[model samples]
Target chain A: MKILVPVKQAALVEDDFELRDDGRDVDPDFVDLQLNEWDDYSLETALQLKESHDGIEVVAVTVGDDDAEDALRTCLAKGADRAIRVWDDELGDADPVVIARVLAAVAQRETPDLVLAGTQSSDLGFSATGVAMATFMGWPHAAVVVALDYSPGAATATVERELEGGLRQRLEIDCPAVLTIQLGINTPRYASLRGIKQARSLPVEELTPEDLGLEAQDVGEQACGARVRKMYLPEKGQAEMIEGTPAQQAERIAAIVKEVMGG
Target chain B: MGADRALESGKAVMGGETVEPQTLIGRLLARPDAYAAAGLLAAHPDFADHRLLRMALPDRATGLVFAGMRFSPACLLEELGGWQDSAVQRRLAGNPATPAPVIARLLDNSSADPDVGPRLAAHVRTPTDALPGLVADGRLATRVAAAGHPGAGHGLLLELAGRGEMPVLRVLSARADLSTALLARIWERGDRHVQAELLRAATCPRQLLAAAAHAPHALWRRRAAGHPALPEPVRWRLLRDSDARVRAAVAEAPTTPVELLHRFQADPAQRVRIALARRQDLPPSWLDSLARQPGAWLQRWVARNPCCPRQMLERLAQSAAAEVRRAVSRNPATSAFMLARLAADADPWVRAGAAGRADLYPSVLARLADDTEVDVLGAVAANPSTPAERLAGLAMHDDRDVRRAVAQNPAASAAVLAPLATDPYPLNRFVVSQRDALSLATLEALAGDPEPRIRFIAWKRLGALAASH
Candidate 1:
């Protein structure tokens, strides 16, 4: 059985400075660095299943420019058997539902028995991507999996979906299916020294929607399910830190209390 | 020798053998000798901000020394009353005698300082007449309570067995050291807002019992019965109290003398009589009296606790309270003559408690299960001796709590649990979910249960079942 894993990356370090959109009208540098926290869990789940099931092969896939290839390469280095890069330079501001269409088109070529993705990409965090992908593929989906089990005839997993009001409950569903894993599932194994060396030699299959019998017209901002009308920081006020001797500070605190109490 | 200069020097000397800055502050903070520190403060204007200097002068006598030092009153107020660790206030309140001048200074200047909330609260015990309302509010209560001196720590504490004065006891009780004093205090004014503090202080059983025992009045004796660890005094009173709660408190008393229980059985309170009927070692005559009981209430209570003296129930079958008579009728342990007596009872709960036993009569529990009163039905539902088939049948009767009781019974079968599986209350579902008797299929049925709490328990149970494999 083959399993397909999609990996997304973001910068490891937070950039303290404001983002500057380069001439392409995109912040290429942000995409040019690091991995998303959620996608890392999805990547690990696939790798672990392949390690335990001798015949299974895990493939890492992504859809972005050359910078994203660095992230896919990182996945391969971690133990994925192969890498697939779907180069799409114009898809930066695309939403999840559209991205899901693109991803499903690419994934059709692999004919994987099961597909794994993160519950949500931290950078975009639509959280609708995996569900959209499952709908597009017409496969049963179980999300936020905390545990998994895979045997030939029956593959099942237990997941805890976060619900309204900070509540969580477990759910189970059969797989040969799509499963989006929440963060901190199984610990992701790091690339071994030998694995890293072997990863450098692995094949990367390059594809586009055209290669998968799809059109670019099926994606981009037009095909997106939602719209972001504005982006700006919310107004904030500075926090005051009162300083004085303990007694003086205490007195101030007491005075505040007195005024509040109207004493 | 220059006598004039010598006299000036005597008064101006900053430190002496017994009055070194450190010892003087430490001792003065600890005793009435605090006058020593006061004296020092009087001498030195700079020492008010001198926390170290005041601390170093350890004795209370040094309050005077502090006063003598002309310490800046502003700074002394700052060091003494600043929100700080208990060690700071503990040192001050521990002073057997506080310097009157310093206290005077506090009263005069307490409101003058900005941090007067905690400071004024801290000194509430300083014998000032102008306290109550200022001390009662939240800010002061929390700060003063937190700044509580060690001896005062016993205010609300349940375990303090010491015989201190009422004020000290009040202080201890406030801190959650629930004891006789607290109970008595609660008893006296427990009906009023005074109970708010006691309620806050003693939520636990031992403390509740101790507090109840010491509760000042009979009303608290009944109130104490509503809570845990029956207070000894409340227990003693409940052995004769008119209220069911009081009697229930007596029934829970681990050391209740059988003789006291005997006298309690004859008390005017029917609830007391009902309570006495539930005990295991009730005298034979008590069972005899129950046999003739006319009321269904007596029989229901009797049947719920089946081990009581059988002879009294035999005699109680003839009581006017239909419930009591029903109790005599439903008793399985009742003799043939006893059954004959209870069979004539007007109330069904009484008959149900004394009804047909295999030894003399058929299980009358079935008849009582159909009684009109919800209370009797509840009695049958709670009675362990009721036949499993009969109990299962009652699981569907309208009351959800009775159904809950039936569902929770160890003897309840799968057939009985299936209907309750659809119970609206999560409590009933939780009971059905937890019973080992419920198969994995039942748990699966509850997996999609609407109540998250129930669903959570079901999931946990499923996980445990999965792990055993």
Candidate 2:
């Protein structure tokens, strides 16, 4: 069995970041790129499944820039059998739908038994990618899966999905399905020194739209299903801090309460 | 059809300008301690005239039922039984006035929503006979709720402890009635996670602690080391445990002898030494030496320690590391002169930290209020020591955060806050509503403000004030 996991490197913006002079977006210099927190769980889930099953393989895939290779290397070091990065200038500004289309094209080529993705990325947070990809592939999908048990012989996977208000729904899905992993399903293991050294020597496969037999126009901004018209920081609220000496403040509060309550 | 016709006829009898009788009656029935009115409304002869029965009761009626209002409890129960909303059923289960038979029916209805079962089991009035079934329910949350239920019997708690799920075990451990035998069963059957939790419980038996002291899991060993009841020999053994985390936990434990704590002050691991540095009970003489250490991190911790000599904070205020300086800036023990000096530091974060201290002189705050950094200005606006005049100036600052901080400053007088009460941002108005010191006039104005949330807060404050009086 082979499992395909989609990983992403999301930007961690500082709390105090300010918009650029034009006020369109935050200044890029203040942003630190790191692994998307949710994708870390997805990758860990795939690795755990591989560890339990005999003759099973895990492939880590991403659609990102050169810097994103760091996340792919981390995946390889953690036990993924292979890494693939899909990059193209046209895909730079791609929306979740466009990214899902590109990943679907790769899935067609890889033809893995299952696809795993994070429930949502920390940055952008478009939770539509995995479900849309599953729809594109005509496969059953479940999101926010907290528990999973699969039997290769039976070709069936039992999963527990987290619902709002602490409710859970148990589902049994057929193979060749997509499952978006939720956090806290398992504690992700760190990459050992030996794994890190081995990862450096592994060649990461790079692909583009052309390699997938697609033109630039096939996955461009025009192909995007949605667009972000504007972005701005939310307004900040103030917390009223009571002042005066402890005794004075207490007395004043008492008087105010009396006035309001009409003693 | 008859009810609709009656409602139309009642509407015709009342002028359109006036509130419909049904709406007024529903509101009255929703009031707290309105049991008599509720009973009267329920028993009204005319179907249309009986507003409570004529109109579909709003969701707020659920809260009134749960508020111990005994007016027509049977009628409310009947009305709730006809509704399919699980939320209403959950409320019914919580209402102490709810009759025992209704609760029993809710329990027996297998098709009832999953959430209702746990609430029923946890209800204070639930019979002991019904608890065991709910405790064994397949849903983990229901089982957890049952285990934590105050009325859970010993047998039910023992069953949950035997289940060995971490959540269930943790809740069972909190019960004062949990027998030693049950604790032992949980300790033996539980996985490493459960064992760690058990070690942390104040009620952990001595036998469990001794056994856990030798557990292979370092987390369990580390937690055991911190147990206040651990034998002295076990504590000493854990101090030298192979894991640094265990040694750190032991070093931080107040039960550790002062002599041992002093020896850990120089441990190779910074975490151990840092833990020692944070102990307020550490001899002041030793604190001097720890302060002299070359590590800036150690100096930062010493600067923040409550027992650190004032002289030490003054000295660390000039350190080259912005972090050390920042730590001193926030330390209450730091002298006013040192805080003023740090407020002008090249690093904006250090200055911002200094700007937030209440002890800073008004002159220093005025200077900080003019700093080029918006965060420093924001800090000044938030400081209680900031003069009302300075707050008035900042309330109109271009930076919305600075203005917000000014609006929130408790020191701002009514004159300073009046303009902000109508500030363009609703959040600013919302902040004004939270001030307990606001004049009654201001709160009354905010109570009628356009924003629903602001109005709600102002009204809540008004209600609290009226009740207090």
lDDT string for model 2 (B1-469, tens) is 0111111111221223233334434444464223323333333332123344433244543333332334333555656655665555666775666777777777776345776777777776678788888755688888887877788887777777777787787677656565677777787777666668778777787777787678878888988888888888788788777788888888788888878766676778877778888887888778888878789998888878878778878778878888888988988778898888998899998999999999998788888988989989999999989988888888877776788898778677766676566565667777876664555556556655655456545544443333222
What candidate 1 gets wrong by more than 4 Å, as runs, is A21-32, A155-168, A227-230, A238-263, B1-469
Fraction of native A-B contacts kept, per candidate:
0.00, 0.00
DockQ of 1: 0.01
Candidate 1 residue-wise lDDT, A163-215, digit = tens: 56867767766666888888877876555434555666777788776777766
lDDT of 1 at B150: 39
Docking quality category of candidate 2 according to DockQ thresholds: incorrect
lDDT of 1 by residue, B255-303 (tens): 6766767666556667667767777776666755764465667566765
> Model 2: residues >4 Å from true position, as ranges?
A1-263, B1-84, B87-111, B122-130, B136-138, B165-167, B170-179, B407-410, B423-428, B448-451, B462-469
Highest TM-score: give the candidate number.
2
| Span of 10 residues, lowest total lDDT, candidate 2 chain A | A15-24
Chain A TM-score for each of the predictions? 0.80, 0.87
TM-score of each: 0.33, 0.52
